[model samples]
Target: MIRHLVLFKLNEGVAKDDQRALAGAEAFAELGSLIPELREWECGWNTTERDIAYDYAINSLVEDRESLQAYLTHPAHQAAAGQWREFATWVIADIEV
Candidate 1:
């Protein structure tokens, strides 16, 4: 299995507390249901706790590196990728499990 994780930081003045955070979370949470190749999808809001950071986080599971690559190249995902530029920052990592 492979784990794909991403943290997004929205542009200043665009995210008003939890509004954008919630919206983005909801969008990502629906991916597995909407895209069959996505084995799992999870989204979360960043907390103020001293040990936590990042505006929003998402984790997805795929079969392997190839499946992960296919997921990224899939049409549904390609469409969604168009929205990433609107965010101020994005961090991602993919690893085998």
Candidate 2:
């Protein structure tokens, strides 16, 4: 399986409580149901207040690299990611397990 992880940081001047941020979070939350290639999905806003902490995170699992690629290029996933691209920067990592 491939474990795909993402950490998102809101851009400067964007507040965590902003409606756009909430909408972005909501969009990601729906991805599990929207995409079929995903074997597992988990995402949420960060509750901790720390300087180095990202504002949001996504942890997902897929069968293999092909599935992971499908998940990444899926239209639904692209749309959700577009929402976040407006006000956040993110990093991702994929691990084989």
Worst 10 residues of 1 by lDDT: 16-25
- lDDT against the true structure, each candidate: 0.71, 0.94
Q: Top lDDT: which candidate number?
A: 2
> Per-prediction TM-score, please?
0.76, 0.96
In model 2, the runs with Cα more than 4 Å from the true position are none
Backbone clash tally for model 1? 0
> On residues 34-75, what C-alpha lDDT tens digit does candidate 1 reach at each position?
776678888776675443467777789988877887888876
Where model 1 places Cα greater than 4 Å from the true spot, the runs are: 16-25, 49-52
Q: Which candidate is the best by TM-score?
A: 2
